[model samples]
Target: MKIAASLRAGVMATAVVALATFQPTPVAAQQASPQQTVRVGIHGADIGSLDPHMSAQTIDNVIHAWIYGGLVRFPAGTIDPTRIEPDIAESWTKSPDGLVWTFVLRPGVKFHGGYGEVTADDVVHSLKRAGDPKTSTFASDFASFDKVEAVDPRTVRITLKTPVPSLLGLVTAQRGGYVVSRKADQEAAGQYTAKAIGTGPFQLEEYRSKQFVALVANPDYFRGRPKVDRVVYRFIPANESRDLAFRAGELDLFYGRKEQRWVDRMKATPGLAIEVFGPGELRLINLNTSMKPFDDIRVRRAVAHAINRADFVKFVGADVVSPNPSVVPLGYLGYTDQVERFAYDPEKSKQLLKEAGHPNGITIKVLGSNRSFVEPYQLLQAQLAKAGITMELQLVEHTAWHAQIRQNLSAMVVYTAARFPVADIFLTQFFHSASAPGKPTAVTNFSHCDVADREIDAARIEQDPKRQLELWHAAQQKIVANVCAVPLFDEDQVWGRSTKLEFGHKLEASISFGPMLTEQTVLK
Candidate 1:
């Protein structure tokens, strides 16, 4: 989500005062007053539900951190390849057979309302709920287990049907696995869609759709209460409007990257700061390989060579978005830089189109949404036109675009996937041949390419880390060589904050709002 840049000075001052008095806490004489409220600006419409099981978008994941707790977490001060840290599960061990895994839970961790202590039952129930097809969770991929048994109050053993080397990494994913309360699950199964109950540091106080969602610190949380008393996430979909709010001081934080103009403006304004991180995500056009025209590798390659990536990055105002050779990005383990990428040549693209039996011309529709992707979509349209490919741009609302893409109704659609700490998650989730085309399942094989079934299968069951990496790299090479999907550029997760908000650089794949928020963040 991108933060808008139109904050006004007077409004910012007023908002700052409100935040200053939000939550009062005792501190040393040298410490400044604790920040009571932190107003966050999000760039999309409110998510329909807060249930971690059902959310698939990045924005939804941001809210999930506040309402839910995972078995493990990517702690602050880590980067690119995130290191796992203990959360609810204090520590865990794997058996020699590689089938049974046991976890030692943190003692005295209680649920909301001072309910019973967190236990093995909660773990079993959460995993079972995630694997259930009716629950709509991506966790089904990792939860296809033989059995989940509670050996004791604080101990749980999970037996897997097959060896999964990346199981822990999967569990750490934002959407995959979260330990939900068994008591709450049974009592609120039907009503849990809108309500959330977890052991995280924050509790959801209120949710106002398309307006804002409020979260208060959980005083009884196993980890101490958050430094900030309350966090208010406001959903502002328009960029210009959001920028206005940021400048006006109606917002304490804005979820956007620094454009040149924004960088200049913020530099001149005191108390406001702009920060830039590496491009850890990719913005690309996914062609439905299951359909015509795209079924031909030459056609796909032609489309890749048609557009100018450099120009697109400049238009988008991002820092370095070059053409990627493979779906697996750089900095990933087993990432091979050996694959060949198509160079920009509109003339060559036209010739390839003619050779592919499109002697006259190829008419195709590019599908996209209007919220955070409008700028990139416009840039793509302009570039594609120069290649002599008659393009029909279909601009739809976010909901409609998601529906159309799932149904495989578009010839091509603009999509972005965040950087996964492990490459297996990206490979198995998105490119696996067996993944169903248009559904809410974790299978991201959106292009509907069926050529890599055997390769993906081989990689999934390979227990040896080095061997699995080799197989995955081989699969990525095959996809790239065929131009199955055209990659545009990597996107950085950007946010704007007050100068007082001090935090370390986030890990490349880090998704948490701000790493410093986890007990480590302190007010200057």
Candidate 2:
């Protein structure tokens, strides 16, 4: 029986209602007996390239957060670009034109494994490397780079072709900004993949793939000695096993399920505490506009109408999930909700499908991650099925799914990501035509979108904040009207931690997508 639009909300609520019945057992006691060693249960089974400039996997990025530092960095537990603090670079100054910028580095900052103290040459080399398309996945972020040169051993200079809203964000301990050891990188002879050696509080000690990566405290670290003696980053992909290990006291911290029920259950556990905050990951289904049936705009609209946004809000719980009325993530610098939105109406969806000459309905194969993402994909499959659209899901390991989707192997892709919290960061990489998959400088344009290229490009160098926001708004309006991708909800980051652990700072926002173990973090 087809699920009518009137009954869609009820059906969606039923999908997650069973999960609420699951209650966690209250622990008799919680212990911090291990002293300083921290064991973390990551959601993935393995790490992707931790080479800073290449990896897109959340697992690798979290690892990068431990072993690397940038000229500037987000304060230990937050992702506020406005509150950036100095790391390698002690201070910086920009010329009147806002094109020429110079950074003065702190002297004697040592690299891991004795590569040598950081120098202007190292900063120059790393920045230049990040700007090179062949060497970095984040090359698109540095498009305005004109040149980077060493002024002296203590200073480096960067010249840009155009002004940006916040240059500090581009060079923070983010995507292409984490500085790698120039000497170590140069001598690795291509063995540098996932072997990150930087000036952070922890240094890589051992790495046994698919098992664990051991990191030891860096006594010579500029940030001071890490409170923990060692950090064991374990790879346990199964949610049940990970949660069991956490509850059994085998792990200090672990990634939790994103559903509200799981969070509430954890909240009820006496020994467990939940860390939920921003930068929230936005989940969206990118329908390949260049592919067969989706190439027809009417079919795209039909797919859009098929999705019931309210159902997702009800399923995830309003507090854990919020409506995304724009193409950009909520709370982003230039986010605007003045755009197109397709209301849920099954009859209109069917009519559109027939109008597009698909009276029998259409079938689409989709690539989905078999990790925490499985739930969302399952929900999506059920929703599409109700609209007479058959969604054949090919669930693969998280890492493989990340790789395959970049190759544009499927007609539909549901991607979850939280980038630098800027409108331009999401716009240029996600919706711009130049960043389309199969292109030389591709980041992620899974839908092969090109509708808003004009506004996206214009917003990059608009200069005025008001005019820039206008450009971004125009871009989102165009993209939504064309149904390039269905903007779903912004679900904040969630992690479960043992109450025995003290992360030093308050558990809040993280751009790394997981709790970062720093020099001050410890087992209470």
Candidate 3:
């Protein structure tokens, strides 16, 4: 159901009644032990898609990670790809020329639904599917791949157009890396988004539109069966409603609120543990330069100077959120002091506005989602108003907001994202003109800044790691100079879990969605 953004209060009241009536599944009761099921509450109203290759949103990637396996994977509960280990691929070897990579598949890894053991052919098909633009929004992530060939029943070789130092890291990431079963994809065909069968420890059991998604442990999983017999992700869009369900014991874990007061409140709640870690999401405001008004750099810079970062950081706790110094956030490489060039000066803002022929200031309409984006934008609206600029917000459902932004409808776009690890990934996806909206292979270039396109393209194939970073930093500086987008802050990833729950690895940080549920995650 599409809940109106303005109807959150009404929905919260009805949601409580509905949640109170929610019964524990039979699978939980059937288990002899208490550690049978884990129910989680998240902020999204629904999953956009579950197909491993198709789903690019963090909400969807979180679910996909559980049901899919990649050739190589980041260590459990971690985000850095440098520490990656073998998954479906037992091991791999690189050619002396550094252009060819050969991977050896694990002998007995089996796909769900009796599709039988995963083979080299499946790997070839999966990579090819990921590279196909029509099938995956992140197909560009694999643009370096020239060919993927199955050398034998157990070996697959991937040839690259150029040696990408971050190739392994890219292949181990959630987007283009996760392997999907060829047999399952073929069987599902038009129904792939709803159905998924992979080599992971959990199998998709049931998916209820706009409500919840249920998964059951895979008994024949290669590593071992998941300790929890069932996992249920309930879609609770309202922050207050999610907190309510979590406090009432309907949810064992839930996504935490970003506001300072809410975090403190949850921290005081007994029997609850809050985990906040980063290099997290970089929350940014993308001013549509392709459209009128924002098309002018002076207007874009005016919008930037009118806002107060100190107020924003203070509002959302300074402990949890930090100032983003560049388009490339703090924790990532290639981040520089380029952001210092734009300071929070309302006087400068008005001057720029005057010079641009808007002495009385201008009003811009912005579209955003209610869950997380709206709160920040509302604060921004108030901040901008102080500088004589008006920010008019039109709120919509999260999914609809995403659809609208991609169509370039909003004058100003509010987005928070955990980008791909490498600097090139962020530059190409967000700054390259080829990936901008309205382009043939557009993905997330919401700002439509094309000046850095040449540098971003050059950085993608730069072999020297240090020089690659330098190029990435230069490209970012260009974006900053153009005032294409305002880098607000990078907030820590926060989640509240029951003290009784244990995810085998340390939940210190993750680049994926949340602390992932591997075969070892279990309820105490």
Per-residue alpha-carbon lDDT of candidate 3 for residues 424-524, written as tens digits (9 for 90 to 100):
77767777787788777677847588888877877777767788777888898888888878888887777777766678877656666676888899776
Better of 1 and 3 by TM-score: 3
Model 2, residue 89: C-alpha shift (Å)? 0.8
TM-score (all chains, Cα) for each model? 0.88, 0.90, 0.91
Q: Please report the candidate that would top TM-score against the real structure.
A: 3
Indicate the TM-score of model 3. Answer: 0.91
Worst 10 residues of 2 by lDDT: 1-10
The whole-model C-alpha lDDT of candidate 1 against the native structure comes to 0.67
Residue 10 alpha-carbon offset, candidate 3, angstroms: 32
Model 2: per-residue Cα lDDT over 1-524, one tens digit each:
00100101111000001111112422321232233667788888787776888776788888888888999998977776778889999999998777899999998799998888999998988898888887887887888899899988998999999976668888898778988888888887667764578888888887778877778889899878998877778888887888787666667678877777877666655466667777778888888988899999999999999999898877887657788966788878888888887999878888999999989888998888776567767778888887889999889976688789888888988887789878888988888998888787677848588899999888887877799989988998998899889999888766777666778886567778877788888775
Full-model lDDT for every candidate: 0.67, 0.79, 0.77
Clashing residue pairs in candidate 2 are none
lDDT of 3: 0.77
The number of the candidate with the highest lDDT is: 2
lDDT of 1 by residue, 1-524 (tens): 23223232221242333323323431221135344666777777786667777767767777776667767776653433447777788998998767888888888776765556889889878877777768755754764478888999888888988777566755553565777788876788566644577877777777777777777777888777777666777888776776777666566677764345555555556567555544356666777787888888878878888878777767656542444567775566666667777888988888888899986658887677765567666666666767777778878888788877777788887787764455666666666665657444536536665556666677767877788888877888887776767777666555666665544334333554333344334334
In Å, residue 148's CA in model 2 sits off its true spot by: 0.6
Clashes within 3 Å, all models in order:
18, 0, 0
Candidate 1 matches the true fold with a TM-score of: 0.88
